[model samples]
Target chain A: MKRARMENELVSKGHVACPGCGAALAMRYVLNVLGPKTIIVLPACCWSVITNRHPECCLEVPVFHTAFETAACVASGVRAALEVKGDNSTNVLAWAGDGGTFDIGLQALSGAAERNDDIIYVCYDNEAYMNTGVQRSSATPWGAWTTTTPATHFKGQEKKNIMEIMAAHRIPYAATASISMPEDLMAKVERARDTRGTRFLHIFCPCPTGWRSSPDLTIELARAAVESRAFPLYEIFDGAKRRLSLDPAPPAPVADYIRPQGRFRHLDSEQIEAIQKRVDEEWLSLLRLIENNPA
Target chain B: MKEVMMGDVAVARGVKLARVEVIAAYPITPQTIIVEELSEICGRGELKARFIKVESEHSALACCMGASMAGARTFTASASQGLLLMHEMLHWSAGARTPIVMANVNRAIAPPWNLWSDQTDSLSQRDTSWIQLYCENNQEVIDTVIQAYRIAETVYLPVMVVLDAFILSHTSEVVDVPEQEDVDRYLPPFKAALTLDTNDPRAFGSISGPMEYQKLKMARHEDMMGAVEVARRADDEFGEVFGRKYGIAEPYRCEDAELILLTSGALGGTAKIAVDALRESGAAVGALRVRLFRPFPADEIAEAIGDAPKVAVIDRNLSVGAGGIFAQELKAALYDRERRPAVFGFTGGYGGGDFTPEVVEKIARRALEMGKPDSPTLWEAIP
Candidate 1:
């Protein structure tokens, strides 16, 4: 029965992603949902490397590898072109990384959102610049230690509130998903695919190599993130109505999410307590927002 | 009907006539009027197109790249700093062979924040594989925009139609804006061989190893070189429809002249007056207006000069370490020839300064008197 229900895998088996890479798994789910009538615009990211090089791509769909900071704008262009070609069916997807979304590509993202361009912008947040050896990005957690932020000088600033920023665009759809919940991720991908204008999907993807976690624990870490509210699973429709996807019963402590990752190994007890308090406060605020803004 | 219009409006008319499908632009001074007029044209529902008011010049070109890759005729306009901002995407558009046409108003790059006529801004992008057409008058500006689409689509290379900032972009002239039917005959609907089509799924600009990369680059180069012939053919086809044709290099009375001066953009008009004055005074001089800058038209330029003993090449833009750009290119083109003329390099009319007839005449006399090319660029300033 499980075999009969499964969708044909779009991403090929042999690929270059590190073992237990949440990003690769996330891509599998995205492609399976998006199907063949999709054109993906990939900026510089781990996926740019994970996908097999020229003459051999992991996905069956056509992929356009563009310059970093151009995924959103390029996708807008692609969407516009498709509209001109009288193609109202194919999905135009901008698949980028945290650095491409939260850092250098912010302006382009804002431009595409403001225009209400018809496209799906998927930003796979791995917390840091993993492709370039785990340099800290704006998406990196408050206390995580990346190569740029050593144990002596861990990241001090909180991760940027990308969901709020995206919501501010007032786009047609904005959602947060986790690789651990493939069904939810696929559902959001499908929702974004169905939405007409500037749909944004922020997927929390764990990097086993960058986060210094056991390769096999990638899924567990991803699930713990959502249960701990470190990375909540939610959706904001029409950019105003907020709805939570998962309500974890007896939700896990933030420590359960942070404990296994080497990036968070430098945090002492007091720092861990501070992180837990911050997560709890954020979770409470999110609940209030969901209650306040009914769909 | 000949309508009195600003140079920028002439460009807009050309874009409309060509039936460009996508216009992505971010306003910068001097070039703003062009897009503003285009915006009005698009708003009135006179033209069927998508007007994308992009956030920045980088997105402007990238949008055009996307539209062109999707097989739509695309255009954009910018000047100075905005053009500089689009440096990276310019290479991408060319390498990807997206046939996009853009109008670049020649303005001085800022450090001192100057917005005047200077060629350095577009000349700086010499290696981006974009076909550059420098217009001397408003009519040529309008005509070249249409021809640009024809040539660019033919060569599958981006085209930058350049005009002097304010001197031409803001100046008004009587331009015969071609009717849509005529322009339609001149430039056919865009049909691309390769595009982002779901019906025919294929990846573009994927990762390439050194050997494949070299071949792609070589193919692009061959196509760019082929544009020289394509541009000439486009000019001929345009003349058949519009009755006015500007060749790669249009020479004024160089048949038996001993001295010839070369100029580009609006400086050509000034040089023409200087050539006539020199001729009336029996100096046996002529002027050649270089319309096409890229696919440099070296042999044509050499042929036009045709053994003139002395050649004075005026450059409104400089290369700092390398004298004058046009002079250097002319010298290099004539270097191996058996009967090479002595090419004099003169720098003048930079930063909005007028290149009056007297200034041009003086440069010509100096070139004739020196009888040989100068080691450095000779500065000609209007007193």
Candidate 2:
């Protein structure tokens, strides 16, 4: 597959985003496709901190920094106002962190999706709430360590199936993308832009600080996420049809994805096996989605 | 033009006259009727607004924020727990300065889940930067809604019009519903200073470091202060067309009275009745009703209390450990006064409990008997 040359010139060079921040890369690719005609609504999260404090901003596009649980609602408002003024071409994007999306902002997001509001809602899932010092979120993967979920008592529940929840709304579009694959991520964003009504994109954004991984391993970890089937690359249209974008010929073990991150260092053989079993279960569920609605 | 109407219905009529473009709401007692009427109007095509049925109070405010940002005049109504659930977004709406308008049917915040009149829910959100106005009757409820939009738009802040649940929300009273043509003429189409226009794409909320955060907060504070005068001007202008007058504080028989009662919401009406009866009985007692709670009319409250021998505050809302919510705010306002009156605080009529004129008279007589300053104030018994 040929990769398109990146054209996110609007993003400033040498900004303060941490090295190997998957969210930063996700923003880069999204801005490349969205161009300068997009307005981003950021709720309280790592992205809010990463964007640098005003009067100096990292992104070229106008950004409205909102409260922790109001990104979707604010974006919805912005989208409506644009349409009223006959400026319907601009893309209104609600960019939030896992905690903002899965917990505090869930009610607002659900309201927007249920109404089929014309806006793009993106959740850059870094597994935990990194900005507030790595507290556990509903999006935190099973058996992960954070300040709130210590290794002695790590997160026991599986990460909430956010994609499935979005699909439940029967929205026009819902997709899972990763920062490792810009082409796939950009393609999903472009598709969302073309479609009307609520569109959701959940990007697997790995946080080196939160995950306790080397900064350089960010892209590799993201790729491991996809290759291990821990975070599969897939899309659902009208919430009914699921299409698998990439099916690896040789699937990597879940250990490949977990071993690099210190957050998952406490998992013993039995615990690892338990996690693997859950991952397998979820992968099978995705496979069923694809098989039931081929293409 | 004056016809009998429920406070909730009057608020709904005001929303229609304002031509609010979007309404997102959920059902809660006291607040349910306002949303229901708005939905009916939307369904009948009497009001061209998108009525979204949301699952929770959080979502209702969230939807309103979205619609407001989209540059549409948006409205929503909630009470008690609903208002509490929308707490996080309340800060967001005000912080973003979306100028969203909300009708808060004042109800007691839950613990035992009682659905009755109280100012606790809206008053608790005092720091959220929302312009809060307490209505004395259905007439003021309608007028305040119109004035809220003008003040909010001028100051670029969200506004909440609070009416007592059951007392005003359910009770029918004579109110002059303004003509739609007059409303349109007075309240112009919402033209947001900042919006999501592709032609002039700009960021709204951005992360601010410690250096810029304080300044941003100060700017919001200044705007809030500006809303005080803005509200007064809006009210004056609204009266010019609608043939009614309102101020931050409405004085009733305060002249030459040795004792005065500071009150809000429908209780003001009851207090008025009590004051009239007391005056007929040759007792020197009057009433002062506070319409605007936030940007608190401190100067006006001071002047209203004047050199009265004693001033009694009646609060229907409790602040838990702090006592009456309004009483606490009132004390703070008069804290530095050179010759402050003996301030008395009374908490009663909570959770939809009625406070009749007899009860008001009783509290007044008790305050007059005490004749001295008291700490933590007095708590009125609901008899």
Candidate 3:
């Protein structure tokens, strides 16, 4: 399949993001698609520190660095003001980490989504609180090792179904894309930009520092997750209809997705089987939604 | 035209007259009416503005910060816990130098879960770079709201206009709502010196080193001190156009008086009545209403309490380990003075209780008997 081409990088080189940081790639794609007429509402996250300090911001767009839990709400305000100022072409983008979006910022995100605010909220899911040094977040999948959820007591709960949570808000658009699939991510961003109401894009951003994985394996891991059906690429419309993005030949073993990362190195065969069971179950459930409410 | 309205409604009218572009608020007790009225105004198309109904107080102020940063004149109102919830964003809004104005109904902070008149909620936020104005009446509430925008915009700082819960917030009085054209002349459209604009892109509240951060903080303080002069000038100009002028501090019958009672918020009204009663008996007592708490109004306070032998500071809030918040500020203001008066700090009305005129007089008489404050702060009018 021919991949869509991107031109003119908005995210300049020499950012502070760790090598092979999926969030950096995701941001580059986002800014490229959204263009320069954008105002970003960035909450406290890795991206907050990743952007170089004052007088040296990499992104050539206005950014409002808000408190930890106010990305969506702040974006809502920016959109409203721009509407009042009669500059409707400028897109207000709320970029947050998984912790900011799924945990601390959930109320504000829900509020903005419920209001059908005119903004695109992007939650870069690094699975755990990476910027704070590998602390466990609600997005930390089952059987994952974080500083808070040490190897002896791995994460007991499955990652929070944030896409479903956003879908429940019945927003105009909500999609799950990946850092490896820049075309799909950019296409979703383009769609969200054209959409008038609240559009949520949950991107699976891999953090090599937090996951203790070989930095070169970041994109490989991102692709392996999707092919393994652990993190299936899909999109939901108006909180109901769903459309699957990929049709792989056959599902790869969950081990292909998990074995490379040190966070999952402690998992035994039975635990891996348990995780595989959960992933397969989740994939089946997602397929059911896609089949029932075809988009 | 003169219209009978509660202090909260007067606040809405003031916001309307100022042509505020965006308003965000959560419905908290005593502060709900202001938001409700603002919403109504927006609904009726009387005020061409966006009224964002935020989920919590934190989001309310955050929304205001965003709108203000987007170069909109923004406003919000809250009370007690709601105001407490907005504490972080209060610092954000001020440090970012967004001249957003907020009305805070003075309600007791909860532990006992009371929702009546107390100044502790707003007073506790004194360190945040917001200009604090305490209103003594519904009229002052309206007038100060208009002046707050001018001073805040001039100084690039946020302003928190405080009114005593129930006493001023719920009680109705005749307030002269100024005409919209006159208000327009007094307060122009907000032209933000810096904001989130695509044409001139810059980050708001980005990371800064200690040296740059210190300079930014110093500049904000300079702006805060500059607000004193701006506030006075705005009031003088407002009086020229609106025919009503209120100073940062109002000295009532304080001239040649031996004992002057210092108070703020609606308690000043009660103190004024108490002063009149004492004057009838030739007690030579007076009242000085400290209207502007921030910018501290130190010089005005010193001038008002000048040469007076004693000052009984009636504080409806306490600093716990320290003395009364206002009394401590007043003492600091007089610390470098040559003719320093004996400042007595008396605290009352904690957790939604009232400090009536009789209680205020009792505190005054006590201060008069003691000649000077022997203790740091004495509890009075407590049940």
The candidate that wins on TM-score is: 3
Winner on TM-score (1 vs 3): 3
TM-score of chain B of 1: 0.98
**What number of backbone clashes does candidate 3 have, counting pairs of residues 3 or more apart or in separate chains?**
0
Count of steric clashes across candidates, in order: 0, 14, 0
Task: List candidate 1 stretches off by more than 4 Å.
Answer: A1-8, B378-380
> Best lDDT goes to which candidate?
3
Q: How does model 1 score on DockQ?
A: 0.69
The CAPRI classification for model 1 reads as: medium
The recovered share of true contacts, given per candidate in order, is 0.58, 0.60, 0.65
The residue-by-residue lDDT of candidate 3 on B133-240, one tens digit each, is 999999999999999999999998999999999899999999989998999999989998988988888877677799889999999998899888888898899999
Chain A only, candidate 2, TM-score: 0.98
Instruction: Give the better candidate number (1 or 2) by DockQ.
Output: 1
lDDT per model vs. reference: 0.89, 0.86, 0.90
Over B1-383, each residue of candidate 1 has an lDDT whose tens digit, in order, gives: 79998889999989998898888999999899999999999999877888989899999998889888778999999999999999999999999899999999999987888899889989999899999999999999999999999999888999999999988999999998888888888888999979877677777777779999999999998998888899999999888988999998999989788888999999999899998899999999999988898878887888999978888889999888887788888888889888788778888677777788998998888888885565666575763
Q: Which candidate is the best by DockQ?
A: 3
Question: Candidate 2 vs candidate 3: which has greater DockQ?
Answer: 3
lDDT of 2 by residue, B28-139 (tens): 9989899889988989999877777776787778767766766889888999888998898898888878888999998887688888888889989999999999998899
